[model samples]
Target: MNLTLKIWRQENARAKGRFETYKVENISPDCSFLEMLDILNEQLVDKLSHPVCFDNDCREGICGMCGLYINGRPHGPDDGVTTCQLHMRRFKDGDTIVIEPWRARPFPIIRDLVVDRTAFDKIIQEGGYVSVTTGGVPDGNAIPIPKKNADEAMDAAACIGCGACVAACKNASAMLFVSAKVSQLALLPQGKPEAARRVQAMVAKMDELGFGNCTNTYACEAECPKQIKRSNIARMNREFMCAKVCSEE
Candidate 1:
């Protein structure tokens, strides 16, 4: 199939960016979205032109590094899949695809389709871990955690930090992402000790990094590749309130 791509091009964080169009032909329907871009880059290189720059580490979708706003949706039209998992077959022949990087102040473009997502790393650094000494891995039955809490914790832990949640939010909020991180730990016994501190620190860092507040638009939950729930946000708000109350007391 032949396709037209209108992709954003930026030289650096401070450089002005714009959409540049290119055409690719005879792409396989089975080709992954990133593979299609690879074909386009190879063609440009043969002509002595610069290739499009995009971030991709694990093409298997586990890494969440390959993020692109395709046709105004994060990770294309697919549900519960990352850009690396998106396929060319999802588009029709001769279709024009618009691709851009995550558009948020916290995720400034480094070039073309790559943005500096270290803001996420910074938020994680703020407290997103079970720093307590839980000793070595215990026997599965030793913990005896309620199955419901364990299930919810595992679900919250599915967040891959792709910034899609931030990109999909009308306010560019990181609430969904932040909440998932908070809930994953707060529900687990290993993480319970620091739940209050972890929630406060991460939320404070999220605000300091210029991420917007959640307005309940639910776009983040809808676009999240892992289907991370907005219920995580509700849990996080409760955690935050409890922390505030405990601190005051």
Candidate 2:
């Protein structure tokens, strides 16, 4: 199928960026979205023109590095999939696709479709781990955690820090990403010891990094590739309130 792609091009974070259009023909319907871009780049390189730059590692969708705003939706029109998992068949022949990087203040563009996501790293560093000393791994039955809690924890842990939550939000909020990190740990016994500290520090760092507030628009939940629920955001709010209240006591 032949298609037109209007993609964002930026030289650097400080450089002015603009949309550049290109056409690709005879692309296979089975070709992944990144593969289609690769075909486009090869054509550009063969002509001695600069190729488009996009972030992608582990094209299997586990890495969450291949994020793109396609036709105004995070990760194209598909649900519960990353850009690397998107196939060309999702589009119609002769369609014009608009692709752009995550448009958030915290995620500044580096070049053509790549944006710096290290702000997520900064928030994770603030407190997204089980730091308290727990002895060696015990028997699986030793903890005896409720099945419901374990399932929810595992669900929350599925978050890949893709930044789609932020990109989908009108306010560019990172609440869903941050909440998933917090919930995955807080629901487990090993993480309870530092849960209060973890929630407070991570939320503080998220705000400090210039991420916007969640206004309950639910866009973050809708666009998340992992389908991380907004209930995690609610849990995070409760965690934050408890932390704040405990500190005063």
Candidate 3:
């Protein structure tokens, strides 16, 4: 198949950016979106041109490094999919694809299609941890947590932090991502001790990182590759309120 691509190009963080047109032919329908970009970069490199830069690791879709805005949607047209896992068959021949990076103040473009997502790392550093003392590996049934909460915690923990949530949001909010981090722990007994301080610290860290406020439009849920539930945000809000009340006391 043949495709016309309008991709955003930026030299560096401070450099002005614009869309450049290129044509790709002989694409395999089975190739993933990032693989397609890889092909484009190889072609440009052969011509001694600056190859497009994008972030990706563990193309299996667990790393969350492969973030891209494809045709105005994060991760293309597929539901609950990341760019690295989006198959090219989703597009037909002669399709014109517009590829860009995550557009958010917190995610500054380092070069073409690559953004600095250390803001997420900083938020995680703030308090996304279990304070329980570690010895050797404990028995599987050492502590019996209800299956329901365990599954909910695992679901929340599945978030890969790709920043699609921010890219899809009109306000560029990180609430969905932040909430997933908060809820994953708040649901576990191992997190009970730091629950209050953890929520407070993570939320404060989120605000400090220049992330936009949540407007509750649910756009984040729509774009999240992991299908992280919007209920995580609601749970986070409740945790935040409770944490604030206790912190004030």
The Cα error of candidate 3 at residue 28, in Å, is 1.5
Candidates 2 and 3, the one with greater lDDT: 2
TM-score of 2: 0.97
**Can you write out model 2's per-residue Cα lDDT over 110-199, one digit (the tens) per residue?**
898999999999999999998767688888889879999999999999999889999999999999999999999989988888889899
What's the lDDT for all of these models? 0.94, 0.94, 0.93
Error of 1 at 159 (Å): 0.8
Q: How far in Å is the alpha carbon of 107 misplaced in model 2?
A: 0.8
Distance from true position, residue 162, model 1, in Å? 0.6
Q: Please, what's the RMSD in Å of model 2?
A: 1.2
Evaluated at residue 8, the lDDT of candidate 1 is 96
Which regions in candidate 1 have their CA more than 4 angstroms from the true location?
none
Question: Alpha-carbon error at 155 in model 3, in Å?
Answer: 0.1
